[model samples]
Target: MEITFLGTGAATALPLPFCNCPLCCKARTSGGKDIRKRSSMAVNDDLLVDLGPDTASAAYLYGFPLEQVQYCLQTHSHSDHFDPAHLITRLPEYASAGVVPMKVCGSSLTLKHMSEGVFREDEGTDMLSPEGMQKLSIQIHQAFPYSTFSAGRYRITTLPCGHDPGDGSMVYCIQDGNSTLLYATDTTSFSQEIWDFLISYEFHFTAVVMDHTYGSGINGEGHLNQDQFIEQLRIMRKNGIAGEQTLVFATHISHEGNSTHSDMEREHAAHGYAPAYDGLSIRI
Candidate 1:
Protein backbone atom coordinates (compact mmCIF):
# COMPACT_ATOMS: atom_id res chain seq x y z
CA MET A 1 0.00 0.00 0.00
CA GLU A 2 1.09 3.57 -0.67
CA ILE A 3 0.19 6.86 0.97
CA THR A 4 0.46 10.25 -0.69
CA PHE A 5 0.32 13.48 1.25
CA LEU A 6 -1.67 15.82 -0.94
CA GLY A 7 -1.12 18.78 1.41
CA THR A 8 0.61 18.89 4.78
CA GLY A 9 0.12 22.32 6.29
CA ALA A 10 -2.26 23.80 8.83
CA ALA A 11 -5.47 25.59 7.96
CA THR A 12 -3.69 28.71 6.65
CA ALA A 13 -0.90 26.58 5.11
CA LEU A 14 2.81 27.30 5.60
CA PRO A 15 2.81 30.89 4.31
CA LEU A 16 -0.10 33.11 5.06
CA PRO A 17 -1.13 35.24 2.11
CA PHE A 18 -0.13 38.96 2.25
CA CYS A 19 1.86 38.43 5.44
CA ASN A 20 5.55 39.33 5.84
CA CYS A 21 6.31 36.70 8.49
CA PRO A 22 9.85 35.35 8.58
CA LEU A 23 8.76 31.86 7.53
CA CYS A 24 6.53 33.07 4.71
CA CYS A 25 9.27 35.42 3.48
CA LYS A 26 11.76 32.57 3.44
CA ALA A 27 9.21 30.26 1.81
CA ARG A 28 8.73 32.73 -1.04
CA THR A 29 12.48 32.85 -1.73
CA SER A 30 13.32 29.25 -0.82
CA GLY A 31 10.69 27.27 -2.68
CA GLY A 32 11.37 23.59 -1.99
CA LYS A 33 9.81 21.46 0.77
CA ASP A 34 9.21 24.58 2.86
CA ILE A 35 6.13 25.39 0.82
CA ARG A 36 2.92 23.57 1.88
CA LYS A 37 -0.77 23.44 1.12
CA ARG A 38 -3.80 22.51 3.29
CA SER A 39 -3.79 19.10 5.00
CA SER A 40 -5.05 16.07 3.05
CA MET A 41 -3.88 12.56 2.14
CA ALA A 42 -4.56 9.77 -0.31
CA VAL A 43 -4.39 6.05 0.39
CA ASN A 44 -3.14 4.15 -2.64
CA ASP A 45 -5.12 5.56 -5.59
CA ASP A 46 -8.68 4.90 -4.51
CA LEU A 47 -9.26 6.39 -1.03
CA LEU A 48 -8.92 10.08 -0.10
CA VAL A 49 -8.91 11.66 3.34
CA ASP A 50 -10.36 15.16 3.48
CA LEU A 51 -11.49 17.15 0.45
CA GLY A 52 -9.81 20.40 1.36
CA PRO A 53 -9.92 23.61 -0.69
CA ASP A 54 -6.39 22.90 -1.92
CA THR A 55 -7.30 19.41 -3.13
CA ALA A 56 -7.79 20.66 -6.68
CA SER A 57 -4.55 22.63 -6.73
CA ALA A 58 -2.56 19.79 -5.12
CA ALA A 59 -3.97 17.32 -7.62
CA TYR A 60 -2.82 19.51 -10.49
CA LEU A 61 0.55 20.48 -9.01
CA TYR A 62 1.58 17.06 -7.74
CA GLY A 63 -0.11 15.13 -10.54
CA PHE A 64 -2.31 13.22 -8.03
CA PRO A 65 -4.71 10.95 -9.89
CA LEU A 66 -7.77 12.22 -7.99
CA GLU A 67 -10.11 10.94 -10.68
CA GLN A 68 -9.36 7.43 -9.45
CA VAL A 69 -10.53 8.20 -5.92
CA GLN A 70 -13.69 6.25 -5.05
CA TYR A 71 -14.00 7.03 -1.32
CA CYS A 72 -13.58 10.31 0.58
CA LEU A 73 -13.01 9.79 4.33
CA GLN A 74 -13.65 13.03 6.15
CA THR A 75 -12.21 13.87 9.57
CA HIS A 76 -14.40 16.85 10.27
CA SER A 77 -16.39 19.68 8.76
CA HIS A 78 -13.73 22.34 9.15
CA SER A 79 -13.39 24.51 6.06
CA ASP A 80 -9.83 23.43 5.54
CA HIS A 81 -10.78 19.74 5.64
CA PHE A 82 -14.16 19.87 3.90
CA ASP A 83 -14.79 21.97 0.80
CA PRO A 84 -18.02 20.99 -0.91
CA ALA A 85 -17.64 23.67 -3.56
CA HIS A 86 -14.50 22.04 -4.85
CA LEU A 87 -16.06 18.59 -4.68
CA ILE A 88 -18.81 19.61 -7.12
CA THR A 89 -16.23 19.85 -9.87
CA ARG A 90 -16.49 16.07 -10.12
CA LEU A 91 -19.93 16.39 -11.63
CA PRO A 92 -20.73 14.91 -15.02
CA GLU A 93 -19.96 18.19 -16.78
CA TYR A 94 -16.37 18.24 -15.55
CA ALA A 95 -15.52 14.58 -14.93
CA SER A 96 -15.39 11.69 -17.37
CA ALA A 97 -18.22 9.21 -17.95
CA GLY A 98 -16.44 6.41 -16.12
CA VAL A 99 -16.27 8.37 -12.88
CA VAL A 100 -18.20 6.45 -10.23
CA PRO A 101 -20.38 7.97 -7.52
CA MET A 102 -18.02 8.90 -4.71
CA LYS A 103 -18.78 7.26 -1.36
CA VAL A 104 -18.15 9.92 1.28
CA CYS A 105 -17.71 8.42 4.76
CA GLY A 106 -17.73 10.63 7.84
CA SER A 107 -19.59 11.53 11.04
CA SER A 108 -23.23 12.54 10.83
CA LEU A 109 -22.43 16.20 11.30
CA THR A 110 -19.71 16.10 8.70
CA LEU A 111 -21.98 14.35 6.22
CA LYS A 112 -24.75 16.87 6.98
CA HIS A 113 -22.47 19.74 6.14
CA MET A 114 -21.47 18.05 2.91
CA SER A 115 -25.05 17.34 1.97
CA GLU A 116 -26.10 20.93 2.64
CA GLY A 117 -23.25 22.26 0.57
CA VAL A 118 -23.80 19.83 -2.31
CA PHE A 119 -27.59 19.56 -2.40
CA ARG A 120 -28.61 23.00 -1.20
CA GLU A 121 -29.30 25.08 -4.29
CA ASP A 122 -30.78 28.54 -4.34
CA GLU A 123 -32.57 28.94 -7.64
CA GLY A 124 -33.68 32.36 -6.38
CA THR A 125 -30.11 33.60 -6.86
CA ASP A 126 -27.62 32.87 -9.64
CA MET A 127 -24.71 32.42 -7.21
CA LEU A 128 -24.72 28.57 -7.19
CA SER A 129 -26.02 26.82 -10.27
CA PRO A 130 -28.34 23.84 -9.86
CA GLU A 131 -26.77 22.00 -12.74
CA GLY A 132 -23.85 20.83 -10.62
CA MET A 133 -26.07 19.29 -7.95
CA GLN A 134 -28.36 17.84 -10.58
CA LYS A 135 -25.55 16.16 -12.45
CA LEU A 136 -23.30 15.22 -9.48
CA SER A 137 -23.48 11.77 -7.88
CA ILE A 138 -22.44 10.91 -4.33
CA GLN A 139 -23.28 8.38 -1.61
CA ILE A 140 -22.96 9.52 2.00
CA HIS A 141 -22.08 6.80 4.54
CA GLN A 142 -22.31 7.87 8.18
CA ALA A 143 -19.44 6.66 10.34
CA PHE A 144 -19.30 6.24 14.10
CA PRO A 145 -16.67 5.28 16.64
CA TYR A 146 -15.61 1.59 16.58
CA SER A 147 -17.65 0.96 13.44
CA THR A 148 -15.78 -0.71 10.60
CA PHE A 149 -16.60 -0.43 6.92
CA SER A 150 -15.10 -1.46 3.61
CA ALA A 151 -14.25 0.79 0.69
CA GLY A 152 -12.79 -0.96 -2.29
CA ARG A 153 -10.02 -3.20 -0.98
CA TYR A 154 -9.55 -1.25 2.24
CA ARG A 155 -11.18 -1.88 5.63
CA ILE A 156 -11.64 1.24 7.77
CA THR A 157 -12.39 1.57 11.48
CA THR A 158 -13.41 4.92 12.96
CA LEU A 159 -12.01 6.05 16.29
CA PRO A 160 -13.41 9.03 18.15
CA CYS A 161 -10.96 11.69 19.22
CA GLY A 162 -10.88 14.97 21.13
CA HIS A 163 -11.43 17.55 18.46
CA ASP A 164 -14.98 18.93 18.32
CA PRO A 165 -17.62 17.90 20.83
CA GLY A 166 -20.53 19.59 19.12
CA ASP A 167 -20.13 18.07 15.69
CA GLY A 168 -17.71 15.28 16.70
CA SER A 169 -14.59 14.16 14.83
CA MET A 170 -12.84 10.89 13.98
CA VAL A 171 -9.49 9.26 13.34
CA TYR A 172 -9.31 6.51 10.78
CA CYS A 173 -7.53 3.16 11.01
CA ILE A 174 -7.14 1.85 7.47
CA GLN A 175 -6.04 -1.67 6.62
CA ASP A 176 -5.55 -3.75 3.51
CA GLY A 177 -4.53 -7.29 4.50
CA ASN A 178 -1.31 -7.02 6.50
CA SER A 179 -0.68 -3.34 5.77
CA THR A 180 -2.19 -1.02 8.36
CA LEU A 181 -2.12 2.78 8.74
CA LEU A 182 -3.64 5.16 11.21
CA TYR A 183 -4.61 8.57 9.84
CA ALA A 184 -5.25 10.78 12.87
CA THR A 185 -5.83 14.47 12.35
CA ASP A 186 -8.16 17.35 13.22
CA THR A 187 -7.94 16.06 16.77
CA THR A 188 -5.80 16.39 19.84
CA SER A 189 -5.16 13.52 22.32
CA PHE A 190 -7.06 10.31 21.98
CA SER A 191 -10.07 9.85 24.19
CA GLN A 192 -10.15 7.14 26.87
CA GLU A 193 -12.73 5.09 24.99
CA ILE A 194 -10.73 5.38 21.82
CA TRP A 195 -7.58 4.31 23.56
CA ASP A 196 -9.30 1.30 25.01
CA PHE A 197 -10.65 0.35 21.62
CA LEU A 198 -7.29 0.83 19.98
CA ILE A 199 -5.37 -1.30 22.48
CA SER A 200 -7.66 -4.22 21.73
CA TYR A 201 -6.29 -4.48 18.21
CA GLU A 202 -3.78 -7.32 17.91
CA PHE A 203 -1.26 -5.84 15.50
CA HIS A 204 0.88 -2.72 15.63
CA PHE A 205 0.33 0.00 13.07
CA THR A 206 2.56 0.09 10.00
CA ALA A 207 2.41 3.90 9.98
CA VAL A 208 0.85 6.41 12.32
CA VAL A 209 0.13 9.94 11.03
CA MET A 210 -0.51 12.58 13.65
CA ASP A 211 -1.85 16.13 13.87
CA HIS A 212 0.72 18.87 14.56
CA THR A 213 -1.18 22.12 14.32
CA TYR A 214 0.83 23.82 17.02
CA GLY A 215 4.54 23.19 17.45
CA SER A 216 5.97 23.05 20.97
CA GLY A 217 3.05 25.02 22.34
CA ILE A 218 0.25 24.44 24.80
CA ASN A 219 -2.72 22.28 23.80
CA GLY A 220 -5.39 24.28 21.97
CA GLU A 221 -8.25 21.87 22.92
CA GLY A 222 -8.49 20.78 19.28
CA HIS A 223 -4.92 20.38 18.06
CA LEU A 224 -1.60 18.91 19.11
CA ASN A 225 1.77 20.60 19.56
CA GLN A 226 5.18 18.95 19.49
CA ASP A 227 5.18 18.11 23.18
CA GLN A 228 1.75 16.49 23.02
CA PHE A 229 2.78 14.64 19.89
CA ILE A 230 5.80 13.11 21.59
CA GLU A 231 3.79 12.14 24.66
CA GLN A 232 1.19 10.52 22.48
CA LEU A 233 3.90 8.56 20.73
CA ARG A 234 5.29 7.36 24.04
CA ILE A 235 1.88 6.22 25.13
CA MET A 236 1.24 4.42 21.85
CA ARG A 237 4.52 2.57 22.11
CA LYS A 238 3.97 1.72 25.75
CA ASN A 239 0.52 0.35 24.89
CA GLY A 240 1.88 -1.75 22.01
CA ILE A 241 -0.02 0.27 19.42
CA ALA A 242 3.25 1.19 17.71
CA GLY A 243 6.60 -0.52 17.45
CA GLU A 244 10.08 0.41 16.28
CA GLN A 245 9.30 -0.68 12.76
CA THR A 246 6.26 1.59 12.59
CA LEU A 247 6.75 4.74 10.55
CA VAL A 248 5.57 7.88 12.36
CA PHE A 249 4.82 11.20 10.70
CA ALA A 250 3.87 14.71 11.86
CA THR A 251 1.74 16.83 9.53
CA HIS A 252 -0.85 19.68 9.57
CA ILE A 253 2.06 22.06 10.10
CA SER A 254 1.80 25.81 10.69
CA HIS A 255 4.32 28.60 10.01
CA GLU A 256 3.68 29.87 13.53
CA GLY A 257 5.36 26.69 14.76
CA ASN A 258 8.72 26.78 16.45
CA SER A 259 10.72 25.08 13.68
CA THR A 260 11.00 24.87 9.92
CA HIS A 261 11.01 21.65 7.92
CA SER A 262 14.72 21.00 8.27
CA ASP A 263 14.73 22.22 11.86
CA MET A 264 11.83 19.95 12.81
CA GLU A 265 13.40 16.96 11.13
CA ARG A 266 16.62 17.48 13.08
CA GLU A 267 14.91 18.18 16.40
CA HIS A 268 12.61 15.14 16.23
CA ALA A 269 15.08 12.72 14.69
CA ALA A 270 15.87 11.14 18.07
CA HIS A 271 12.19 10.35 18.56
CA GLY A 272 11.83 8.95 15.04
CA TYR A 273 9.23 11.50 14.03
CA ALA A 274 9.50 12.74 10.46
CA PRO A 275 7.81 15.95 9.43
CA ALA A 276 5.50 15.58 6.46
CA TYR A 277 5.72 18.03 3.56
CA ASP A 278 3.40 18.44 0.63
CA GLY A 279 3.67 15.75 -2.10
CA LEU A 280 5.62 13.29 0.06
CA SER A 281 4.75 9.70 -0.83
CA ILE A 282 5.38 6.64 1.31
CA ARG A 283 4.96 3.01 0.32
CA ILE A 284 4.10 0.67 3.19
Candidate 2:
Protein backbone atom coordinates (compact mmCIF):
# COMPACT_ATOMS: atom_id res chain seq x y z
CA MET A 1 0.00 0.00 0.00
CA GLU A 2 1.22 3.45 -0.86
CA ILE A 3 -0.09 6.37 1.19
CA THR A 4 0.44 9.94 0.10
CA PHE A 5 -0.42 12.84 2.32
CA LEU A 6 -2.03 15.32 -0.01
CA GLY A 7 -2.37 17.90 2.75
CA THR A 8 -1.72 17.78 6.48
CA GLY A 9 -2.81 21.04 8.01
CA ALA A 10 -5.71 21.76 10.30
CA ALA A 11 -8.83 23.60 9.15
CA THR A 12 -7.13 26.97 9.40
CA ALA A 13 -4.03 25.55 7.67
CA LEU A 14 -0.43 26.13 8.85
CA PRO A 15 -0.38 29.93 8.72
CA LEU A 16 -3.33 32.12 9.50
CA PRO A 17 -3.58 34.58 6.63
CA PHE A 18 -3.84 37.69 8.83
CA CYS A 19 -1.76 36.58 11.80
CA ASN A 20 1.97 37.15 12.07
CA CYS A 21 2.65 34.70 14.86
CA PRO A 22 6.15 33.24 15.09
CA LEU A 23 5.15 29.92 13.57
CA CYS A 24 3.06 31.43 10.76
CA CYS A 25 5.73 34.01 10.05
CA LYS A 26 8.37 31.31 9.84
CA ALA A 27 6.13 29.25 7.57
CA ARG A 28 5.61 32.19 5.25
CA THR A 29 9.35 32.84 4.99
CA SER A 30 10.47 29.20 4.89
CA GLY A 31 8.03 27.48 2.53
CA GLY A 32 8.83 23.81 2.31
CA LYS A 33 7.41 21.08 4.48
CA ASP A 34 6.31 23.87 6.83
CA ILE A 35 3.74 24.93 4.24
CA ARG A 36 0.59 22.85 4.65
CA LYS A 37 -2.85 22.71 3.04
CA ARG A 38 -6.12 21.40 4.41
CA SER A 39 -5.97 17.77 5.53
CA SER A 40 -6.46 14.99 2.95
CA MET A 41 -4.79 11.77 1.77
CA ALA A 42 -4.53 9.49 -1.22
CA VAL A 43 -4.22 5.74 -0.95
CA ASN A 44 -2.16 4.33 -3.76
CA ASP A 45 -3.46 5.91 -6.98
CA ASP A 46 -7.12 5.05 -6.73
CA LEU A 47 -8.57 5.97 -3.36
CA LEU A 48 -8.78 9.32 -1.60
CA VAL A 49 -9.55 10.08 2.01
CA ASP A 50 -11.32 13.42 2.18
CA LEU A 51 -11.68 15.38 -1.08
CA GLY A 52 -10.99 18.65 0.64
CA PRO A 53 -10.88 22.17 -0.76
CA ASP A 54 -7.15 21.92 -1.33
CA THR A 55 -7.13 18.49 -2.94
CA ALA A 56 -6.73 19.73 -6.51
CA SER A 57 -4.01 22.16 -5.58
CA ALA A 58 -2.20 19.57 -3.52
CA ALA A 59 -2.38 17.00 -6.31
CA TYR A 60 -1.04 19.54 -8.77
CA LEU A 61 1.76 20.57 -6.41
CA TYR A 62 2.66 16.97 -5.53
CA GLY A 63 2.31 15.62 -9.08
CA PHE A 64 -0.57 13.26 -8.28
CA PRO A 65 -3.05 12.56 -11.05
CA LEU A 66 -6.50 13.31 -9.71
CA GLU A 67 -8.21 11.57 -12.60
CA GLN A 68 -6.98 8.20 -11.37
CA VAL A 69 -8.88 8.42 -8.09
CA GLN A 70 -11.99 6.22 -8.13
CA TYR A 71 -13.04 6.09 -4.50
CA CYS A 72 -13.35 8.62 -1.68
CA LEU A 73 -13.85 8.11 2.05
CA GLN A 74 -15.31 11.28 3.38
CA THR A 75 -15.01 11.81 7.15
CA HIS A 76 -17.66 14.49 7.39
CA SER A 77 -19.19 17.52 5.74
CA HIS A 78 -16.77 20.07 7.15
CA SER A 79 -16.04 22.74 4.51
CA ASP A 80 -12.32 22.19 4.75
CA HIS A 81 -12.70 18.47 4.13
CA PHE A 82 -15.53 18.27 1.56
CA ASP A 83 -15.82 20.84 -1.21
CA PRO A 84 -18.97 20.47 -3.27
CA ALA A 85 -17.71 22.98 -5.78
CA HIS A 86 -14.76 20.76 -6.54
CA LEU A 87 -16.88 17.64 -6.77
CA ILE A 88 -19.25 19.41 -9.08
CA THR A 89 -16.47 19.93 -11.55
CA ARG A 90 -16.80 16.31 -12.54
CA LEU A 91 -20.15 17.07 -14.05
CA PRO A 92 -20.58 17.07 -17.83
CA GLU A 93 -21.27 20.76 -17.71
CA TYR A 94 -17.61 21.30 -16.89
CA ALA A 95 -16.60 19.51 -20.12
CA SER A 96 -14.39 17.11 -18.23
CA ALA A 97 -13.50 14.28 -20.51
CA GLY A 98 -13.27 10.62 -19.51
CA VAL A 99 -13.93 11.28 -15.84
CA VAL A 100 -13.59 8.11 -13.83
CA PRO A 101 -16.68 7.06 -11.95
CA MET A 102 -16.35 7.75 -8.21
CA LYS A 103 -17.83 6.00 -5.23
CA VAL A 104 -18.10 8.18 -2.13
CA CYS A 105 -18.49 6.45 1.23
CA GLY A 106 -19.59 8.25 4.36
CA SER A 107 -22.26 8.38 7.06
CA SER A 108 -25.79 9.09 5.90
CA LEU A 109 -25.85 12.49 7.53
CA THR A 110 -22.53 13.41 6.00
CA LEU A 111 -23.70 12.34 2.55
CA LYS A 112 -26.91 14.31 3.06
CA HIS A 113 -24.98 17.43 3.90
CA MET A 114 -22.68 16.87 0.93
CA SER A 115 -25.70 16.61 -1.31
CA GLU A 116 -27.07 19.78 0.20
CA GLY A 117 -23.76 21.47 -0.37
CA VAL A 118 -23.85 20.55 -4.05
CA PHE A 119 -27.37 21.86 -4.23
CA ARG A 120 -26.25 25.08 -2.70
CA GLU A 121 -23.61 25.44 -5.40
CA ASP A 122 -25.85 24.45 -8.29
CA GLU A 123 -29.49 24.81 -7.49
CA GLY A 124 -31.55 21.56 -7.67
CA THR A 125 -28.49 19.35 -8.05
CA ASP A 126 -29.03 16.60 -5.49
CA MET A 127 -26.19 14.15 -4.99
CA LEU A 128 -28.51 11.80 -3.15
CA SER A 129 -30.67 11.27 -6.19
CA PRO A 130 -29.92 8.69 -8.84
CA GLU A 131 -30.27 11.21 -11.64
CA GLY A 132 -27.93 13.61 -9.93
CA MET A 133 -25.38 10.89 -9.21
CA GLN A 134 -25.51 9.67 -12.78
CA LYS A 135 -25.01 13.21 -14.01
CA LEU A 136 -21.82 13.46 -12.01
CA SER A 137 -20.72 9.86 -12.56
CA ILE A 138 -20.69 9.31 -8.83
CA GLN A 139 -22.17 6.85 -6.36
CA ILE A 140 -22.97 7.33 -2.71
CA HIS A 141 -22.46 4.44 -0.31
CA GLN A 142 -23.82 5.20 3.13
CA ALA A 143 -21.59 3.69 5.79
CA PHE A 144 -22.33 3.08 9.46
CA PRO A 145 -19.98 2.82 12.41
CA TYR A 146 -18.45 -0.65 12.89
CA SER A 147 -19.50 -1.77 9.45
CA THR A 148 -17.07 -3.27 6.99
CA PHE A 149 -17.26 -2.78 3.23
CA SER A 150 -15.24 -3.26 0.10
CA ALA A 151 -14.12 -0.60 -2.34
CA GLY A 152 -12.12 -1.98 -5.24
CA ARG A 153 -9.20 -3.96 -3.79
CA TYR A 154 -9.45 -2.46 -0.32
CA ARG A 155 -11.38 -3.69 2.69
CA ILE A 156 -12.56 -0.77 4.81
CA THR A 157 -13.91 -0.77 8.34
CA THR A 158 -15.67 2.29 9.66
CA LEU A 159 -15.00 3.43 13.19
CA PRO A 160 -16.81 6.19 15.01
CA CYS A 161 -14.93 9.37 15.81
CA GLY A 162 -15.36 11.81 18.69
CA HIS A 163 -15.64 14.89 16.51
CA ASP A 164 -18.88 16.03 14.89
CA PRO A 165 -21.06 13.38 16.44
CA GLY A 166 -24.05 15.00 14.80
CA ASP A 167 -22.54 14.27 11.37
CA GLY A 168 -21.67 10.72 12.42
CA SER A 169 -18.06 11.44 11.63
CA MET A 170 -15.90 8.34 11.23
CA VAL A 171 -12.32 7.20 10.96
CA TYR A 172 -11.22 4.32 8.72
CA CYS A 173 -9.26 1.10 9.06
CA ILE A 174 -8.22 0.12 5.56
CA GLN A 175 -6.66 -3.15 4.51
CA ASP A 176 -5.09 -3.99 1.18
CA GLY A 177 -3.02 -7.13 0.65
CA ASN A 178 -0.63 -7.44 3.62
CA SER A 179 -0.90 -3.85 4.71
CA THR A 180 -3.41 -2.13 6.98
CA LEU A 181 -3.75 1.57 7.74
CA LEU A 182 -5.61 3.44 10.42
CA TYR A 183 -6.51 6.93 9.21
CA ALA A 184 -7.91 8.94 12.09
CA THR A 185 -8.10 12.71 12.06
CA ASP A 186 -10.32 15.68 12.84
CA THR A 187 -11.07 13.82 16.03
CA THR A 188 -10.50 13.71 19.75
CA SER A 189 -8.99 10.79 21.65
CA PHE A 190 -10.49 7.43 20.83
CA SER A 191 -13.38 6.27 22.92
CA GLN A 192 -13.36 3.08 24.98
CA GLU A 193 -15.81 1.52 22.59
CA ILE A 194 -13.45 2.16 19.70
CA TRP A 195 -10.54 0.70 21.64
CA ASP A 196 -12.57 -2.35 22.52
CA PHE A 197 -13.57 -2.74 18.92
CA LEU A 198 -9.99 -2.58 17.73
CA ILE A 199 -8.94 -5.10 20.35
CA SER A 200 -11.79 -7.42 19.46
CA TYR A 201 -11.01 -7.17 15.78
CA GLU A 202 -7.35 -7.96 16.46
CA PHE A 203 -6.31 -5.34 13.93
CA HIS A 204 -2.59 -4.81 13.53
CA PHE A 205 -1.87 -1.63 11.67
CA THR A 206 1.02 -1.18 9.23
CA ALA A 207 0.61 2.61 9.33
CA VAL A 208 -1.35 5.11 11.38
CA VAL A 209 -2.12 8.75 10.59
CA MET A 210 -3.81 10.40 13.53
CA ASP A 211 -4.88 13.87 14.62
CA HIS A 212 -2.41 16.23 16.25
CA THR A 213 -4.24 19.47 15.86
CA TYR A 214 -2.69 21.14 18.88
CA GLY A 215 0.88 21.15 20.11
CA SER A 216 2.10 19.91 23.47
CA GLY A 217 0.31 21.39 26.50
CA ILE A 218 -2.28 23.03 24.27
CA ASN A 219 -5.93 22.05 24.61
CA GLY A 220 -8.31 21.99 21.66
CA GLU A 221 -11.93 20.94 21.48
CA GLY A 222 -12.80 17.94 19.29
CA HIS A 223 -9.15 17.33 18.41
CA LEU A 224 -6.09 15.81 20.01
CA ASN A 225 -3.09 17.71 21.36
CA GLN A 226 0.45 16.41 21.40
CA ASP A 227 0.12 14.89 24.86
CA GLN A 228 -3.15 13.20 24.06
CA PHE A 229 -1.73 12.06 20.73
CA ILE A 230 1.20 10.36 22.43
CA GLU A 231 -1.11 8.77 24.98
CA GLN A 232 -3.20 7.27 22.21
CA LEU A 233 -0.09 5.83 20.58
CA ARG A 234 0.83 4.26 23.91
CA ILE A 235 -2.59 2.70 24.17
CA MET A 236 -2.32 1.36 20.63
CA ARG A 237 1.02 -0.18 21.44
CA LYS A 238 -0.27 -1.65 24.71
CA ASN A 239 -3.22 -3.18 22.93
CA GLY A 240 -0.98 -4.65 20.23
CA ILE A 241 -2.74 -2.65 17.58
CA ALA A 242 0.65 -1.19 16.63
CA GLY A 243 3.98 -2.97 16.66
CA GLU A 244 7.50 -1.57 16.73
CA GLN A 245 7.75 -1.71 12.96
CA THR A 246 4.48 0.06 12.41
CA LEU A 247 4.81 3.40 10.62
CA VAL A 248 3.03 6.13 12.53
CA PHE A 249 2.45 9.74 11.54
CA ALA A 250 0.73 12.70 13.16
CA THR A 251 -1.38 14.88 10.84
CA HIS A 252 -4.01 17.65 10.84
CA ILE A 253 -1.38 19.88 12.37
CA SER A 254 -2.13 23.46 13.36
CA HIS A 255 0.07 26.49 14.04
CA GLU A 256 -1.32 26.94 17.52
CA GLY A 257 1.60 26.04 19.78
CA ASN A 258 2.97 23.76 17.09
CA SER A 259 6.43 24.38 15.74
CA THR A 260 7.63 24.16 12.14
CA HIS A 261 7.81 20.80 10.35
CA SER A 262 11.49 20.13 11.00
CA ASP A 263 11.24 21.08 14.66
CA MET A 264 8.12 18.95 15.05
CA GLU A 265 9.97 15.95 13.62
CA ARG A 266 12.82 16.39 16.12
CA GLU A 267 10.40 16.92 18.98
CA HIS A 268 8.27 13.87 18.17
CA ALA A 269 10.88 11.38 16.94
CA ALA A 270 11.18 9.71 20.34
CA HIS A 271 7.45 8.97 20.42
CA GLY A 272 7.56 6.50 17.48
CA TYR A 273 5.89 8.90 15.02
CA ALA A 274 6.77 11.97 13.02
CA PRO A 275 4.53 14.77 11.84
CA ALA A 276 3.23 14.23 8.31
CA TYR A 277 3.63 17.09 5.86
CA ASP A 278 2.06 17.86 2.52
CA GLY A 279 3.34 15.66 -0.33
CA LEU A 280 4.86 13.08 2.01
CA SER A 281 4.41 9.57 0.64
CA ILE A 282 5.03 6.20 2.28
CA ARG A 283 4.81 2.69 0.93
CA ILE A 284 4.45 -0.53 2.95
Q: Taking the tens digit of each residue's C-alpha lDDT, what string does model 1 give over 34-65? A: 88899999888788999998987898787778
Top model by lDDT, which number? 2
TM-score of 1: 0.92
lDDT (CA) for every model shown? 0.82, 0.93
Tell me each candidate's RMSD, in Å, in order: 3.1, 0.7
Off by over 4 Å in 2: none
For every model shown, the clashing-pair count is 0, 0
Clash pairs detected, candidate 2 = none
- What's the TM-score of every candidate structure? 0.92, 0.99
Poorest 10 consecutive residues of model 1 by lDDT?
121-130
